[model samples]
Target: MARSQKQKSVTPTPPSQLDRFDEANSARLGLICVQERIPEDYTRWDIEFLVDDRPSRLTCISPGEYGGVPHGLDGDFATILNVMYLEQGAPESGIVHTTAYQMLQRAGFPDSGQYYQSLQESLDRLKAATYTASESWRDHKRQRWTTVKFNIIERITAETQDGLGFGSGTTLKIQLARPVVESIREKYLKPLDMSFVLSLKRSLTRSLYRVLDAHRYQPSMTAEAAAEFRINLQQWARECKLRETVPARIKRNLESAHKELVERGYLTSVEYEGSRADTVIIYTFGDLPATTPAPEPVIEVVPDAPVTDALRRYGVAPTVARNLVSEFGESLVTQRLEKFEAMLKSGYQARKKSALLVDIIRDQGGKYADPEGYQVEPQRSEANLQAATVAKRMEAEEAQLNHRLQEEFRLLDHSEQAARALTQVRMFVGREVSERTLKTLLSAMTSEQVEPYEVYRAVTRAASELRLADFAHELRYAYGD
Candidate 1:
């Protein structure tokens, strides 16, 4: 029979069969080879195949080819075809050709007319002739491998783009059950060492109480005993080489802890039944260790002579004088006595002078009588008596002139004070004043002025009347006007 046109176009192609067999066999073999080498865990694998002297397991597949392979033919079609084969597969034969073209287009490969179409057509033809072998055995063998591969790929993509990886670079996401986070913080995050020390300190008080209750020691702990305990604790801290001071925060904590334990009825007082010296020793230790020696008592002695003198001079009671003598030494007592004597002597002299002056004035007429005494004369006639009186009056006037001259020198001191006040006011206020104001202010001051209180008052009043009180007050009080 002659060759039919249909037979020519679709021949019984043996080469196509051989090509399909070879491709399927190769794919199956590749899977088996890689399965043994690849790790089951995602963490162990690399994204790309490892390079070696042997043929590489991975084959690159272009989006323009191998698009028609059945899903069952590979565990992951894109990975198997695109990453395994170089897009060189059998020729197109049926509807698989059109499907392959669509897959390539979906994969973002350009549809550049005939060249891409021809490649898809070849891949489709290969798929048609390829035996549809059962993938069940391979799937069973490489199920773990396939999972690892998928995970690895996912991790690699996340790591390169999102910074997820192993070691310090790895990011962890934690999800705590409700209330667990707070519980964990409360149980663990508190200062454990401080708590431990506090507990130990509390236990120490209990131990001490047991000793006291058993009558193992002496009387109730005294202030000295407490001080000793503090000192010992400080020494312990020092010996331990602690960074903090013993008298500081640590000691405070210990004291608080001890007090708390005592309040909680963990300690009891023990009575001392011994001699006076032994009793003193017993109370000194309390429940603390009796290691440090007691400090010696300090006694001060004072003499009685100076104290007695001070009492008489200052009008202090005898009992008070004795107490002061006992409390302070003789030197301080003597110094105070001398000061009191000096003050009393000065006061007495002032009073005596005043009394004498008062007596002299009283003898004259109970007032400050004129220095000259009045005189009367019985002369030959009234004219003669009058002349004698006039002569006496002239002598009195001359005596009065001498007294006035002596008093004038005393007034000079006050005049200087008034002058200083005027100068101060002028310098501070810096205002021009009339001569009348100056004279009026000076006239009010004492003739023998020591301090310028009157002068200051006069100037202050004049400033107020002048309507410059604010400025003048500032000058007087603040600027020394």
Candidate 2:
């Protein structure tokens, strides 16, 4: 008798899920150069834009580095780095622990000496570069546009290096700048389709896709996606730091990218309107695979589940309730819901109560964090309890100090406020940062319309940048212990 044979089943490997970036960084002007083969001697790049009907500037400066500012391949390295950082859970320390080999692998680069050398050069460029954004950086958490200066990679510490200073075994601790770190922590991010992005053949196309994605899909829009985008040709050139401002030149440069994107189903078409400087470029979206990965299969919450019942009682849709419980877990959903209920009981009237409750859960904002029913540790030592109490007291004191400082600043006339902020900036951050801060303040104030909040925020932020401990000490001394 012949024996029966069975075939083994094999599951296909899924495409890599590696893409995300702070929307601000992706959209910032002149942060990443679109040009390939930038001269090593190039040191600065600047771009101007109209933000809220006001002129804004972004400047990139790199000094004392042979690589000058980041351009071309550096942008690819940056995307890979950001993806790795998010993949590691966006630790509060702002440090992403990774290896050069791992980064190359994620970027789909081969493990070879040539690629390793290229990675090292990119790291050097990133470390040396600094960006100054004048009223162009969007702080989504604060819901404002503000001035900021930061490096893409603040510092890098490698555990082991070969003769070339970076190797496959070299473990890296890459620290992001405070602004970038804060944006990630606050979830001011947008999805990137790394599979599609990396598949693009041209660096310019990849750069265009990243910048355009920011314009196409924003965090604030209620619509799930944006289908069209329009921009002036000259302004687009300047935004991308392209040397070509003439319409024909710009279009010629973009022609290949346009064709590539259209062929890849990322854009339906790229069309032009008018001519010369008045030319406008229009981009129509296509059915590219979603930038975000598909959600995991939903596990429906049982009718008897406490979280589901609680959500239902609040008039949440069944599908929404199940997703909330499945995505954030029942424990956190319950916690946030309880917090929302407490707010309602305290006379906090919400126009859309269900929506507000969902926001409270998803945002994890401070408004709903200090409510009753917070999770507490099961056991605590006497010393640990004392330490926790001290920490809470310190936090309260810091909050009070911040409120007092802002209040005092608000009380001053505009001129007085500017003078005070400049003094503090110079005292804490030295002459360079102070001069830049003053320049931004003067520029903004001299404009026909000025935003006091933006000016004050910039100065205060600069003061806390380089010498925060000293700044705090001075503030405490002036205001009293």
Number of the predicted model whose TM-score against the real structure is largest: 2
lDDT of 2 by residue, 1-481 (tens): 0111121121111112323343345544446877766676678878877777878888888974647777777778887777666654565466776667667766656668787788888888888888898887777766878898988899998755336466665667899877876666566666556656656677777777777766765434222346678999998887777767689988988788788778777788999999888899999877533343322211111123467768877888755886787887655676677678877877777898888888888874576555454443433312344356546765765575566557655765675455444333433333233334445644555452455545456546655465565654443343322
Please report, as a residue range, the 10-residue window in candidate 1 with the lowest summed lDDT.
150-159
Per-residue error for 243 in candidate 2, Å, reads 2.1
Question: What TM-score against the true fold does each predicted structure earn?
Answer: 0.12, 0.57
* Tens-digit lDDT string for candidate 1 (422-456): 54454334344444444444554444433454444
Which pairs in model 1 have colliding backbones? 59-84, 60-85, 90-122, 90-126, 91-122, 91-125, 92-121, 92-125
Off by over 4 Å in 2: 1-23, 28-30, 218-223, 288-481
Give candidate 1's error at residue 143 in angstroms. Answer: 8.4
How many residue pairs in model 2 have overlapping backbones?
A: 0
Name the TM-score of candidate 1. 0.12
Regions more than 4 Å wrong, model 1: 1-28, 31-102, 106-108, 131-481
In order, what lDDT does every prediction score?
Answer: 0.29, 0.65
